[model samples]
Target: MNEIISGEKILVTGGAGFIGSNLCEVLLDSNNTVVCLDNFATGKQENIAPFLKHPKFSFIQGDIRNLEDCLLATKNVDYVLHQAALGSVPRSIKNPITTNEVNISGFLNMLVASRDHHIKRFVYAASSSTYGDSQALPKVEENIGKPLSPYAVTKLVNELYADVFFKTYGLETIGLRYFNVFGKRQDPNGAYAAVIPKFVKQFMQLESPIINGDGTFSRDFTYIDNVVQANLKSLVASSTSVNNVYNIAFGDRNTLNDLVVYLKEYLAIYKPSIEKVPVIYGSERVGDIPHSHASIQKAKKYLNYQPEFSLQKGLQEAVDWYWKNL
Candidate 1:
């Protein structure tokens, strides 16, 4: 087993985004020397603003699509948490070429850089969307289907590249197939904003929330803290866990309709009028999967994974953050 030690140099690509920023904060708190590389495309400096002055923190404003930048960021780094990419199915459907350049090309650049830098381990964010078109109730890593969208294709490609890198270059890599991750710091103003934060913001402003696909589409909705924990664990897990992919999600599912009800109930404390607001249903979204659940046994066995937050508890904490910030 490889133990993650204090004072190790770590480079976190996309470290200014929601999940990346949380991971940066955790690593910095644990006494790791952290370098954050981001282009500010979807990531905001405000997310990592507090860490700017920390002694062990460094920020490099650069894009991973640029090979020089990737190489420079990997210098003397012990580990890489590659999180930079364009996310969202609708966004990918609208402009797939751009998504490919960032997710696939950019990822390849990072892999090459990490291999050359001799980094001990590489952990990148893979997506549950990779299980596209598979009708299985709980998705497992070994059983996957044809990708349904450009975004799915990009993520599936990530797993493929990671596998090849391990076999051909002897680089240790782990891919985390994240389900619907949501929590504080998730952007609520974007056109392709995720459902949880988007709905929380709308309901806070007394606006009716929209439900795609008749509100029956369900998701595992893993919280951000669990994701941060998974990343840390992946970096420090035993050699037996290396060169593999794991499903990083809470083993539960909730329909969109159920999510709306939960959000309304939580928001009612701040806005009692929200209890009366109705949700509007629309046609199913293209590139949207009907249901998503993950079989997390592999992660549990290999990484000693133990998720501590449930949907309700996470949602309440997220709602409180929005109430104060938004």
Candidate 2:
């Protein structure tokens, strides 16, 4: 992957959350002066505690919903990796008002701040959930269906705002449509926890994981490292007009059943008896997309996104983390 300019001042909104925290660490390692902005509404302090002592890292406890906080966090920043937003379809379904307040309104606040600061580029987290109800196997950037839940709507609005910001204000922006991203620091305890981490935690505890469907539903399951690479490439891409969206994924599909089997195998190294922990079938989740896969050709051609970790390889690392951390 191409490297972002070393020592560039970068502001990472929501840098205390799963994907954001991971991105901040990578950016710091690349020798950038990183500023992390988060309100801890959903972000965890422990996620960013390790970097507190790093000379290149600075933390700003703030909310994107507040324009002043956004301005404070982004002052003199060269680039903005806008990752702050409320996530979870079920949660959005339960309470879309709050999701929109955070995901949409807060996003607008950040864009205004980034525009005012004249940041070099703005790369924000878009989602596969934006493909809602579109039965296409390999979701492309151009084609999109109506959003199924409020969360999908929130993510879709980010893309729309990003495109408009680039066109109207001449601010360069790129949206990465991530598909099923998972890794260390991705919280596995919440009611809205992701499948991989949640399953790994359950298996480690000798508890049967509840699959939300018949184990046929599948996803691309992009690893966090690949996502971090995508963010880096987005920052350094040289195209004249980057007002576009790229699907960041490994471009491989695996059924939920396949995922559990691999998790069992990998976790068996830590606890030999975990292989026997069965997965219980439950009714499919409401508004759940039956299958999700991605076409990474666009990202590969434009952003030089070459994913190195497959599902099994990433799962092994995640299992190792949950084994020791949990």
User: What lDDT tens digits, residue by residue, belong to model 2 across residues 10-110?
Assistant: 99999999999999999998899999999998899999999999999999999888999999988999999999999889999999999999999999999
Model 2 worst lDDT run, 10 consecutive residues? 1-10
* Prediction 1 global C-alpha lDDT: 0.93
* Residue 280, candidate 1: alpha-carbon lDDT: 88
lDDT by candidate, in order shown: 0.93, 0.91
lDDT of 1 by residue, 246-289 (tens): 99999889999989989999999998999998888888889899
Which prediction has the highest lDDT against the true structure? 1
